[model samples]
Target: MEALEARVEALCEQGNALADLEDHAGALGRFEQALALLPEPQDSHPSTLWVCVAIGDMLFLLERYPEAREFLRRAVALPDGLGNPFIHLRLGQCAFELGDKRRAGDELARAFMGAGDEIFDGEDAKYLQFVRSILLPAQDA
Candidate 1:
């Protein structure tokens, strides 16, 4: 079998490149491949939270909300205080898309709080703002 670290690194590189190009389908594929190579949940492989976050991000981009939720939920369940705010952000997005306004607001708020200044860079931040300022309020009405 290939070295797990090398395989994961290669897959991550490919997925990132594909995501940068807006080729979400290809990115999802690469991320799924990486997820497949990841070791099962064990005390030794604590990096599974990171892997789950990565996969959840791609799945969210692909509009696979249920799958994204599954991955994000797993990442959130990790006991290591290594919480990934991005996963919550993506979960918020998925909840928003599914029209769960209350849950979306809560999740998004957590994401914004958790992400701090890091959430202000790309379109992700823009969308998060849009949801916070426009979508959620609109839904509340």
Candidate 2:
């Protein structure tokens, strides 16, 4: 178990390095390798949260929204996932791309409430605009 943990950590580091180099596909592969090493129920593994998020984030960067959404959705149900701003932000972006306006709004609002608009900084403006549109309406009403 310790060996596997070390391996996962190494893979995660490599994945992050690749991400920093703007090699999203390479990052995704490394993250996937780390994920595949986890036990049967990957969610039970502590690394699942970050690894899944990394994979989902890389996929999102690669413009694979549907696949990214699937991964982020699974990750959101894992430990410490619900209030994670990054997970919610990516999930929202994926949902928006897939034309799920209601879900996109819900996730984006969670993200905004958790980390504020800065989480949307690296991405496009439309997500923040959409979140405002959704939340502002409720606030006014």
Among the numbered candidates, top TM-score falls to 2
lDDT tens string, model 2, 17-88?
Answer: 999999999999999999999998778888898898999999999999999998998899998998999999
Tell me the tens digit of each residue's lDDT in model 1 across 1-141: 358888888998898899899898898788778877777653246556676777788888788898888888877777652345677777778888888878787777776778764664564565567556743565634
Q: For model 2, give the RMSD to the true fold.
A: 2.1
Name model 2 segments beyond 4 Å from true. Answer: 137-141
True lDDT of residue 110, candidate 1: 76
lDDT of 1 at 78: 79
Q: What is the lDDT of residue 107 in candidate 1?
A: 78
